[model samples]
Target: MKQWKPAASALLAFSLLLAGCSSEQDAVSKPPATQNKQEKPSQPANAAAGSETSKEIPDAVKKPLKIAAIVQLSIGTFSSQYAQGLKEQVNEFGGDVQIYNADNDLSKMASYVENAVSQKVDGILLDHGRADALAPSVKKAVEAGIPVVAFDSDLNIPGVTVIDQDDYSLAWNSLRTLAQDLNGKGEIVYVWVGGFTPMERRNVIYEAFKKRYPNIKEVARFGNASQNTALDTQSQMEALLQKYPNKGDIDAVFAPWDEFAKGAARAIKQAGRDEIKVYGIDLSDEDLQLIQEKNSPWTATAATDPADVAKLQVRFLYQKVAGEETPQIYSVQPHLVQKSALPEQKVSMNDIGKYVEGWGKSDAAISAWMETLSKEQKK
Candidate 1:
């Protein structure tokens, strides 16, 4: 990435713009009806239209806006994908983003936030950390006038903007599919691990599921896939299968995250229980392969293209720093993927980019900004 430095004139102009622009410019201004809901459109966003850059093309934008992306639990592929989006979006907008992995350690995450503040970075993107532990430092950064956008963290701090995967909708869409598959009555096993904000939000829907469909009995609810999540979950699935050897005892498995769903599918396959179906949240090339496999128990999922999600987050922060309006809470909407929807040929996550159609790009505040950039480039 090229290094960016602002000219004195550019800095002065940007300061003026920031002072005058309204918050509406930084927000998801009157998103379409389907946005924020669980509904997936038959057609995806138009990738061919391309993402636009900010209009006006302030000289300050030519100066790279330095941002620190502090992430919690950089262990899994999903996290890696999310980071990919962040880096790609910042680079697209001529900004430099340095990602600080917290490794799921609260203290490290807290310290990273403080360090960003001390360094006086242009902005900070907090990814997947506990709000309780990081709120104090987040408050300090916001009070200091540093724009902060959090992804998957339930930080209720007044000034900070929050962007999430719409966890409740993601869960509802996937679980709802599973329920329909079972005709609303069956024995199901829920694989989940608590502590993370996204998971907690999904749990809220899980509790709601119990209330809404009392006929669906949750035979077993236990999972601890923290360190080696995939392997650990596979082991847990094996144990669950042993406890309920009779195939008829369990009709379906609800593993909100793909890792758990993969494990459960493997265990069911090994146990010759192909009858059990697995539904989950989040999808990737690997997850798609499992779903497409013949006789595979992994059925369907609700997900957002992680790369698109990351870019949206970066754009939100960029808009904030650019003196544009932003929203308090933005939901990167999800789409449902069933086994029938999988492509016949083997493909990677990147291949799905065209199909997902930029993952609802126009609904994002950044889309409007990008439109200005496109027109400017044409000039």
Candidate 2:
């Protein structure tokens, strides 16, 4: 074979390099630019394992827990409304709430508290029941690591939180309205049902009225009576009216609740004293209807939003159970509602009485009221 020249070998080497580069370019150009479907490799094993672990944990275990509510009485529009509110809020927050009604029996309330403790409830919401009566049970539960929250009625006991209405303010404002309506002077007959929070509020109102309005005289102080016992309230009212025959002297009658006001209204009507102004606490739909009907002399009422109070109490309890910080006491503001302030159409007793029965009978009416209430709240 003839010996190859150095220049020829170098040129051959250059040609081979060019051929390799051209082949690579052709391979790249062969695939469609828009049709490339290559997938990037997945995350490393450690990161993938961590993500899987995170997803396996259940939310219930990671988040807050259950609550139990104890109520004083099973009946009445205010209590029922509050219970409904509490239930709705608890359901919304992904928590369990069990409500127990003591039926106005203190012993029953104590038993319910004990039962709740034994059940290992994460928290408790006490409504309109004496704190002192349930203190032992509450203390035991707290020692067992469960928290207690009180609403409407408070014990002022340590380690227990209270959420309540400004009773003193409510009393002051209500009496002031009565005084103004009576033109700064009148003989006022006061009636109140004893037990729970209202009794305390009644006492406050009486004291404040005496101090603030020397012109307003207390014509009568009636004892504790159930709201449903209209006969008893009527008897008491009649007795007072008989004692003070001159209707001109009695300018107003003050009742602590709507039902009591109803009794007073019946007595006032029977006595034919339409000029006497009637004022009371609680603006239950029944009372609202009474106000709207204009049949009764119930001109104004000092109203506390029990539903809002219940919701706030439940929210505070939820935070405590969830290991979140919250206020020791949450106060619900009260309003003074007059009949004139209500809607122009004026709902009838026949229509609103259906709602006063605890959202049980009339679904449509309850829904409408709830919607209206929601709108009012937003405003």
Candidate 3:
């Protein structure tokens, strides 16, 4: 099986790095009565069909390719696992990978992208930044013949591909689950931020969710994304708990980001408000542990493995390098994980697939040549 690992570092700013945070949307949203299969990572059908000879390969796709991964934040285990997958995939193809984390600074992230272009790296993989901050650098990289692939950022530049975890669907899945658990009526706390593409999309779904479940009310709302996201979130959640000291004052926390989930869960547990549930949108080793803990308030989350996401991003980058036709936008599918399904005996992300169907690696963006490259690398 392909090795795979979110909770991006869990808040990715948990959608924009949080300062003070806050959104609305339309259309009543509900889960499909019959769930559809997760879509595979996609590319042009022939994107994978490369000629067999070594001479057929391009220098850009060749081994020792120098690549840069510019990330907006790297505070959590989710980010570390993502980097691990990237290195793992790049290693299979034999390349030099440099990952730069901006510590939630958009300016630094932009600079890192510019630096990558100046260095003439073969490819750039970007995560979580604003369009205004990143578009110019992304265009620069493309103009220099360096392929740029982004995850959770808005870059409309031609020749750059954007990958996302379908945050709207992710949020809806978890929110829908929460609604179902509460029988469509409950008071919820919203932990969120803005200025992120993923977060915005999720917010769209959230707005729809509220419209659909008019009975559910948002009692308290608070969130921020920072270097100390979990800690800050925990502090905020604690404060909210104090404001609503009575049991059942907050029925649940809709933290579409894993970092927010972690914080809310901790706060609820610490306050001995085990009755409040947390519904989140990303997962990691730490997240899984929390969800599985005895009476963890964090009961459910929707996520795709970050490592698998990293590997697919690398594959798409390589595909672009090979002069293949690739899609402009690709979404990594997410799966709902209920704490009740996970084994209590300690399991890692790599092994949790058995417990959660569609939780591990995917064929998204995978090509025959890519598989061939992996086999070749093994030799």
Candidate 4:
């Protein structure tokens, strides 16, 4: 066994352990199948590698590395998938991770960071949240010589590496695909939930869309403010449809995320308007299902692989901790998937689940997949 120095502060440890135990309880209470399947594959390979690697650590640094993970939310499928991936990778590396949730509360996040510092963990992984609110605590960790890695969030802080999606490009590509489907000229109703990083990035992409396609007019814009507020989005869309009753008045609907797109689709279904095409981001199982169903309003979506982002963050953090050179910022590219592309193929949550579940069964297969992905990125 290798002993290593703990990097977190005392308070950080207690809060993290308490929160982690609570989360573990919730995880234990859920049916195994219901738990996000995205994390399963990476666990076995990383865990086995980690166990073997631990033996390489000299007795001088024999302590286990303690890591604290802070996430923006605890319940969503996207967040859950990211968490699962992070955990699997950490376990694979032969380390322990204590998870914490801010529940979108900035103050709780600040406190969580403080707690992790007190607990004296070796490192901390931060998900989406306010970077400024965490600055003081993160600075303290850096001053104390603990490495901090941020994922799915932008923290313009020193000594913290950020691994996140290329949201601007993703939004632009998704909208472009929608525009191409509409043949460049159409009235689009853009629905968005503001404040989140993805939404902010989408705003930039929306601006680019205006420049790229001069004829595509944004007839209406709705802001829901909550990520999972489907009812609010649907209500907004219904109002828009009523206001613009003429089928020729609106050509398409664009949403910043899948939930918003789903909301728009629901509104279109209720209105009995199948002519309006819909587009959004985050290609989760549900979004793919909507695309597969013929006569559905959802025609396309931009795919952001949360599991891949999580894995990149873990790998980058490992390099940083190992004193190897790493990029200060890593951006994961999003893919555009269309309904027509999946002719005979079906898309389901089970498909995503199968990919993640398979990782635990074979390290060679996962490694091969990762290598292919890397090669694609280079191209």
Give the candidate number with the greatest TM-score. 3
The candidate, 1 or 4, that scores higher on TM-score is: 1
TM-score: model 1 vs. ground truth: 0.81
Using lDDT as the measure, the top candidate is 3
lDDT of 2 at 224: 54
lDDT of 4 by residue, 299-354 (tens): 87776666656766766565456543443444454556777666557756435434
- Candidate 2 vs candidate 4: the lDDT winner is 4
lDDT of 3 by residue, 183-293 (tens): 989899999988777787788667767877899999978788788889999999998888999987889899988888998899899888988999999889999999888
What's the true lDDT of residue 41 in model 3?
21
lDDT of candidate 2 vs native?
Answer: 0.61
**By descending lDDT, how would the candidates be arranged?**
3, 1, 4, 2
TM-score of candidate 4 versus the correct structure, residues matched by position: 0.73
After superposition on all CA atoms, what RMSD does each candidate show versus the true structure?
A: 11.2, 27.9, 7.5, 14.3
Question: What TM-score, computed on C-alpha atoms, does each candidate reach?
Answer: 0.81, 0.71, 0.85, 0.73
**Position 50, candidate 2: lDDT:** 19
**List of clashing residue pairs for candidate 1:** 23-325, 25-325, 26-324, 26-325, 26-326, 27-325, 27-326, 52-370, 53-370
Give one digit per residue, the lDDT tens place, for model 1 in 245-301. Answer: 886799999999877887888888888898899999898767877777878988888
The positional error of residue 303 in candidate 1, measured at the CA in angstroms, is 0.9
Reference-based lDDT, each prediction: 0.73, 0.61, 0.77, 0.64
